[model samples]
Each structure stands twice: as C-alpha cells, then as structure tokens.
Target: MAVAYDLEGQKRAYKRWAPYYDRVYHKLLADAHAKTARAAAKAGPDILEIGVGTGLVLPWYPEGTRVIGVDLSFHMLERARDKMLSGAAPQTRLVAAMDACRLGLADESFDAVAVPFVITLVPDPEGALDEAMRVLKPGGAIVISSKLGYDTGAMAKIEEWVAPLMKKVGWSSAFRIERIKAWAEARGDVELTEIAPLFPAGWFKLMRLVKRS
Candidate 1:
C-alpha cells in the first residue's frame, strides 16, 4: 500500500494540474479514447468509469449509453460535475471520493468498465484491477488506455534521478504497459487483447480484458 502522505500528495498534485490537464493530455486522450470506445462498442451499456477525472471521455461515449463515473479527488469530481452540468454527457452519473481499490458499487453490477490513464496513479494497481473485475458482470469488458513504457533507458535513468524530487513535489512514478497486462491476466476469467500502439513513441496502448462468465 502506498503511504497516505503519498496518496494525498498525488491528489493535491492532480488538483493543481487540473486546469492544465486537458491542454496537456487532450490530444493523447482523444486518440486513445476513440480507439478504446470503438473496440468497447461490443460490450454495451451500464458503463462504469473509474478515475474519471474531469469527464473528458464522457463526450465520446456512444449515444444512449449510461455511465457511472467515480473519482478520488473531490476537486476533480467537482470539475467533472461542472462539465456534466454544462451539457457534457448530460446523462452521466457521478460518484465522489471513491477509491479504485475498493469500489463502493455492487458486484457484477456493470456491463463494462472503462479506466483511462488511472492504473499508474494508484499505489496497488492489482487491487484496483480486482475491484474493477468484481464490479463488472461476467462476460463484460474492461477498457484501459494509458501512457505506458514511460520509464526505459534514458527515460528510466532520468526518472531514477528525478523520482525522489518528483515525489517530493507530488508526482507519480512512471508506468509500464506490461505490468498492467500481467495484472489483468492474473485474474482467471480475463481474456486480454493488446491494441496497436499510437503516436509519440509507442507510449500509448489500448488494453481490453473481457471477464468470462
């Protein structure tokens, strides 16, 4: 488990970054969300969105789709709510202060679960994935899109040197796609599929894991 101080620091950092987040991450998120949503079209309805910061992906959801979005940061959720209120995905529901590792939702409650760029932020990603799996109905799918492989070679060296400083200033450690795949596959019922890499040095990957009945 990550220390409470680390978690709180992360939340504070993200809150501070919220204003500029869309500008910084929008292009990457747009491409990834489009591809992931297209692939997830087969899953159908009652989607649960974990770590739904600012609800940027809410607009990309197919028409008539229902959404239940959960987030840890109250500030982020407030922004998401404001977006929703301003006619962004008018039907999407919001849940404030929910932890990814311990979802408050009932088991097998949703048809699909979408988690974009969230795994890397959590301290125990395995626990978070397990919670996602538990809430998804059998045969439902979990769609995840993230910037992976951010720590390698030169990047790894830079991170190793800068991580302590970054953590002190409330930044998260880098994530690797391979780790997420392994975590997903650890669940006995999951069937994993790795999507083609997008721009910016194969850093983005779309992973789809279907839960078997």
Candidate 2:
C-alpha cells in the first residue's frame, strides 16, 4: 500500500504491481480498453497515450495508427516497450517514462490522446486533463476509461468504507467523470459524451471528448 501521492509513490506501487498487473487487471479492463481503442483509432494516426500501463490497449489499436505511450513508472514502461518489440504492439511507436501532468511536448502535437484508468491514480487529474488539452490538435479527440464511485447504492457505501484501503493499495475509489466533463465544457470549445460502460458491471465509464479549437 502506498502512503503518498508523489511520483515516487506511483513508482513504488507500480513497480510492485508490474509483475502481476496484466494477469489481474487485463481481463477486467479488456472490454473497456477495446471499446475506447476502437473509437480512438478512427480519430487519426498520431496519438499520445498517457498512463499507458503495460500497453494493454496497444494490440487493439489499428495498425496504421502511430502511438506514443508514456507512463510514470519505468517498470511499467519496460513492459510496454517489451510488448512493442515483441510485435504484440506494432502500433506503439514509442514507450517512455514521463509524468502525465507535465509532458514536455509541443502544443497541438497529437491528433488524439488516450487516458485509460489513470485519472484516479494521478494526484492531480485536472492538471493532467489540461495537459491533454494542451497537446491535442484542434478537432482532436481524447478517450478516457475510468471506474468512478456511485452516489447512491449499497455498493457506494461499500466503496466509501474501503476507499482508504484501496488508496494504500494505489488508487482512489472516488474519482469523478463529471470533473472532466465540466473542464471540457468550461472551455466552450469541446464536445463531450458519457458512453455506457462496455462491461456489464457498470463500474466503469468511457468519456469521449473532442476539442473543437
């Protein structure tokens, strides 16, 4: 369990999780990742994927779509790079270590951006969203898949009880999709959609937002 929200904490948690993350998380997130990737692939070729954990969605992207993947954890990025070199992720043009909130890329550098299961993990999700907006080209799209807390439900009560424990294990149980929606809407130059969860459990959501700049 991690005790902090700093980069070092992310590295610690991810380094420990890297070895078994695919087995535990891949199956659970497969449907969500696949659905988001399918929609994003149609956006354009040049794509930047933040928090590209283990490159799980790598194989799903279209062949011609070029992708640059960045993650805060080196151990995780190593896994992503391996997938690329092994031909399991031919669309992955590059996999490198970087912070999502401050990627030093040029403005309008990408045709699209993908942020899968990352908002809750990062310390500053709003800053990360702003960065995504900064790097994306006009008319570019952003796809995010996240599991957010329910406001009213027996499960919601359970989540509230276990959130602290989950955080120690490395994620918040209460990250909100509304924050992302509001941010985009506030810009007054974006299109946002709340897609139905691809998985039947309905714990996750796919947010598709397009910059109209």
Candidate 3:
C-alpha cells in the first residue's frame, strides 16, 4: 500500500516541479485560482494564503490586502518571494517557506486564510485546516479552490484510477468535501459561507467558511 500523503514526498516533488510549474499548472488551472483570490481579497485585507504557489494568486489580491503566503516547497516559495520583491505582488506582506500543518504565526492574527488547490495536497488535510483556523481571527474567512473528492462528476471513476499518477504531480484525489465540512462542524467555530461550483470544470468548487463570532 502506498502512503496516502507524505509531506517530504510532496516537498521533493514540488522541488522537481517548480521550474515548469507556472507554465503547466498555471495553464491548466486557468482562472479557477483567480476567482478564489478575488473572493479572498474581498474577505480580507490581512490574508494568509496557505499554498501560494509561485505567487500566482498574489497578482490578483487587492492592493490593500496584506497577504502572507506560505508553502513548504522552498523552490516554489523562492518564486513567490521574488514576485513580492519585484513589486509584482504589491500587497504581499511576506512570502515564507513554511508548512501548512505547522504554521508559526500568532493565533488569531489573520483576517482570512486562503487555500487554493492545496488542502488535499498536504499530508494532513484536517491538520492544515485546523492550522488555518488557528491563525485566523474570529469572524475571519477561509476560501478554498480545488477539485473535491466527491463522486459528483462523470469522470470521477476515471480520475480515481489516475489518482496515483496525479499524486506525483502534487495532489491527492482522496480528499472529500465532507471532510472539510466536518472539520469546521466539529470545531463549532465556523459557518459555511459559500459552496459555489467553479465553471469550465464542474469537478472543482469555490468554498468559503467564516470563523464564528
């Protein structure tokens, strides 16, 4: 049996993937991430983007939002940091190479947390979400843009078969939407704010959960 999620494996994988990531993943990702970024900007002027790969979402953030983006991949984070230094990410407060499951930020410090196509990619999705909630201020928001694990689409079966290969590309197909909901519900500290389908690909969704007051 293969390990479902290995943080070190993902780190090594992303390191090998960083150079061509923007061209390949960016092209296929299209505007799915942009939509989430826009929503995140509106929800927060102090945002923490969990997987700010290559600073792709940085360009879309509002000018006033202070985005603190983190990624475990040093190679990927280097690109994000470069964008911030070059003024490509004008509102980026900082871009650090850090783990999602174990963040070093102060509790209740961020107004919102953004995880774009990233939760399922981590070793512990629940832990990652917990950490997101950890640093987020009460009433803060969380935005997620990614392909869910639910079997709603016609390609679900086919996707499942190819999931093993996809894992090498830095994502797990085993993550369920219900898992995300359950995490929030278990904490009793968040409300489902949005669960809209992302267009062009119905397999994906844009979700928002607001921390309770």
Candidate 4:
C-alpha cells in the first residue's frame, strides 16, 4: 500500500492550487453542491459541513439553515471566507483548523452532517466518519458526495492511475464508491440511501446515510 499522504504536504498543495482549483473543477463542484443541498433539505436543522472548501455549497443551502463549515487548511478557509463575503449564504458560519478525525464538538450536536468530496483525502476515513457520527444526534443524517470506488470502465481506470500522481502533488485519493459505502454501513446505526450520479458522465457519487437512534 502507498504511504499515507502527509497533511502538511496536502495543505501546501491546496494553497498552491487555491487560485485554480475552482476553475478546473467548477462543474463537478457545482453538481456536488446541488446534490448536497438536496440531501440537506431532506435532513435539516443544526447542520455541519466538513471540508467546506471555498464554501462552494453555501449558495445551495436552504434559507435560514444553521450551517457550520470546518476546514483544515487556513488558506482554503480564507478563500472560503472570500466566497462567503462575495456570494456565500449569509447564515453559514466558517471555522478554521478543524481536523476531521477529531472534531471539537459536543456529542449529538447536529441534526445532519455533510462531507463533500472530502473523505478520500483523509488518511483515516473511518476515524473521520466516526467523528461525524458522534456529533450527529440520533437519527440525524450524514451526507457524503464523492467519486470513491467508482467503476466507469476506461475513465475509471485512468482516474485511478492519475490519483497517486495527483496526491503526490496535493490532490486527494480517488476512492472506490463501494469502499466508502461499506465503511459507512459498518457502523450499525448508519443506513446508506439514494446513491446518485453527478457530472463528468459517471464520475461522481452522492450518498446519504441516517444514523439510527
């Protein structure tokens, strides 16, 4: 197995790409926002968003929703702040330097949690999901949108091959959808639902899970 990507290296890579990340992945990001917003609508009230890079999903958030965004990179958070000032939903709150594996929040504090294209980036995905589940109230939902474990024939193979190189430069791993689903379901209280498609012709996956009471 390849060694885990270093967090500091990942941070620097993101900072370097902050100027171009959105431009290169705008379409995929937009689709994820739409999907996340729709899922959030189904599960509402106190909401938490992990890896809220550049606050791309802010616009789609339901009006009056109590949304809190957490990101690991300060530079990315700064860009998110800029987006918030320019166009993000006014109600969204941004928090900097929050680690996914150890979220500093009370137990069952949120009605729903969202992780958009973020899990694959963490070396300890299970730990991060556990933290997500810990902060969500019983029956609260966790929505994750990613391209993990996806199989789209040649394109999928190409993406897998390119993933490591991208990581070496600062991009997160391209995960398989099945692995993500399995990991989520491994926790007894979590139930997976509504796996959906996004853009790039079979390149993205959106998954919703509800934590059992």
Candidate 5:
C-alpha cells in the first residue's frame, strides 16, 4: 500500500488539477457535496470546510450561513476565491491557503468542520483530523464526505495495487474507513453520529462525528 505522504507532491498535483477540478468533479460529487453542506448547516451556523477545493460545496450551504474554507493549494483557492467573488456563494466569508495538518485557527471555535473528498488526500489524515477535532466546539460535529477503501477483500487488494499510482495524482486509493473509525475510538471525545454510503456503489461515504460536551 502507498503510505508515503508528500506535501510538495500534493501541492504540485493540485496545482495542475485546480483549473479543471470543477469540470471533472462537480457533477460526480454533487450529491455528496450537498449532503455535506446540509449536515454541517444542521450542526450550526459557524462552519469551516477543510480542503475546500474550488468551493464546489460553497453554493450548497444555506443562505445566511457562515462558511470559512481552507486548502493547502493556492491554485485551488484561487478558483474558490473567484467563485466567492462572483457572489455565487455569498455565505462564504473567507477562503485561504492553509495546511490541513497545521490549521492556523482557534481551538474549539467552529460549530462544525466539513471535510469533503479530502481525508484520503491529506498528507497526514490523522493529524488533520486532530486539528479538526481541536477546532470543533463541544457538542458540535465533524462531517466528512470521502471515498473510503475496503479493509479486506479483492477490492482492497486492487486499491492497494493502485494506491501508488493514485498518490501521484494527489490521493490514496487504499485509505480505509477503518482508520477513521479507529481515530474516533481512540479520541473518546467524539462519537460516530452518522455514516451513510454515497454514490457509485458505496465507494463514497458521508460520515459525521459529534463531540461530547
């Protein structure tokens, strides 16, 4: 399996992908984006979206919502900034270039943290999740939409085989859901509130974790 995490590689990959990211993923991930937005909105008004590439989920957030987005790729944020400036997603107050594993944000600040199709792409997913949980307020939630790999099966084998190739493009194909589950269990500060499979035969998933007060 591909376990190496190259920050520079990710940056380079996304820089190349930013220009046409929406054209490639907008429709494919529309449902998941909408669902993620709704889940975050339901949690509360103060929302932070991690790896908010191209701001595809921005317009989906309800009117009057406070949305802040962050990504490691300046190129991707440029596109997202353009979308924000177009007034397509007026709810978005800010979009900045920030590292997922080292967010320059306050602790226990946001009511909800949304990570869409980003966990597996993160260089250090556990560290990123730690940051997400740190920024999340008690009683708030961390919502995620991602393509999770199988833990054991022929599909898992295939994912392992393809992981290295996928890494060059900016994400891991063998990132398992069990890793997230283990993170939640280890934290003991959050609980699994929801885990629903998304399109393309359950390859994608929408998961939520509520922080305990």
Candidate 6:
C-alpha cells in the first residue's frame, strides 16, 4: 500500500510546479476548466475555488462573477495573484494561501465552490469536500473535475499498480468515484446533480453536487 499523503509534501510538489503550472496545464485542461467554471457560474455570481492554482479557470468564469480562490502553496497563489494583477482573470476577487480541508472562510458565504483537478491531490479528499459543503449556500453547487479510478477492471489494476508512483508526484490515480459518491450518500443534505466525462478518453470527469435548499 502507498504511504498516506501529507500536506507538506503536496505543498512542496506544488511549489515546484507553480511556475510552470499554467504552461503545462492550460491547454491540456482548457476544456475541463472552461466547463467547470461555467457550471459554477450558473450557480450564482459568488464562487470559491479550492486549490485554485495559477487561477487558470478564473478567466473562464462569466464576466462579473466574483471568485475567491485559495490554495495551500504560496508559490502557486503568487502566480494566481499575478493573473489577477495582469487582468487575465478579471473574475478573481482574491487569492489566498489556505488549506482546502480547513478553509478560513465564512460558512455558507459562497454560491458555488469549484475544485478543478484537485480532489485526488489533497490529503483528505472527503475533508476538502466537507469544507466545500460547509461554505456553500443552500441550493448551491460544488463543481469538481478529477481523474477517477476504475472499480474492477484491467484499468483498475493499472491504477493500483501506479498509485504509489503517482502519489509521490502529488496525486493518486487510484482515487475512485465511489469514494465521492459515498461521501454524498453519507451527507443527506447533499445531492449528486450531474456527472460528465471530459476529454482524453473519459479518464477525467466533472461532478456537481448541490446542497439541499
């Protein structure tokens, strides 16, 4: 089994990835980012994006959307700050260094929460989702884009085999969709509203969970 992921190691990995994040991920995740941002925007104007590295999706939100983004890595937040200053991401209102699992924001303050490509990277994915739910307004949505692991197939075995190696780099391909489903099922206040596959052969997917009104 792979060692449990820690926040420190994850921060360190993002620090190294900070400078090149947008360059490396911008085009590759463009569709996912755009779709996620648009979905969040549909919820309302106020959005909180957890693990908002480099603010790549900030620019994709509808104009007038007020987005407050947080990340654990200062280096990553710094680049995101630059995007705000450069006018590339006008929807961004603030970018702070904060842990996703323990958000320092007011409860029920946001209309939606967007977490793109971050669920598998966090040390506690369910904890992060809990925080997202804690801050989301009733009837609001939590939008997530992630690479989900297969349950029982050849692909499942492959993800399991490479999980340790992937964990070392910062994310786990062994993270399963059932885990998120279980979390939602455990919380009766939340509902799985939508799930759709992204590009690159459905390895990545977008999920939306809505809080009960």
Q: Any runs in candidate 1 off by more than 4 Å, and if so which?
A: 1-5, 150-174
Best by TM-score: 6
Report the C-alpha lDDT of model 6 over 1-213, residue by residue, as the tens digit: 343658789888888888888888889889999999999999999999998988888889999799999999999988889989999999899999898888999999999999998888787788899999999999999999988876888867877887788678655666788899999999899999898988765657899999999
Tens digits of per-residue lDDT for model 5, 19-49: 8999988998888899999999998999999
Q: What TM-score does candidate 5 reach?
A: 0.88
TM-score of each: 0.82, 0.87, 0.87, 0.84, 0.88, 0.89
The lDDT per prediction is: 0.76, 0.83, 0.83, 0.78, 0.89, 0.89
Stretches > 4 Å off in candidate 3: 1-5, 151-173
Positional deviation of residue 5's Cα in model 6 after best superposition, in angstroms: 6.8
Q: Candidate 2 residues 93-113, lDDT tens each?
A: 899888998898899999889
Residue-by-residue lDDT tens digits, candidate 1, 1-213: 443536678789878988877787778568777666565556887889888887777778787677888988888887788877787776576656788988888999988898887877788888888999999999999988775554458755655676677667544446776686677667668888655665544446677888988
Better of 1 and 6 by lDDT: 6
Assess candidate 6 and give its TM-score to the true structure: 0.89
Give the residue spans of candidate 6 off by over 4 A.
1-5, 152-172
Worst 10 residues of 5 by lDDT: 166-175
Q: Model 3 over residues 43-64: C-alpha lDDT tens digits?
A: 6688999999788888878778
Please state the error at residue 89 of candidate 4 in Å.
Answer: 2.1
How far in Å is the alpha carbon of 201 misplaced in model 4?
Answer: 2.3
Error of 6 at 61 (Å): 0.6
Q: For model 2, how big is the CA root-mean-square deviation?
A: 3.8
| Model 1, position 59: C-alpha lDDT score | 71
lDDT of 4 by residue, 99-178 (tens): 88889899998888999888887888888889999999988888988765555677677778877776675554356766
Whole-model lDDT for model 6 versus the true structure?
0.89
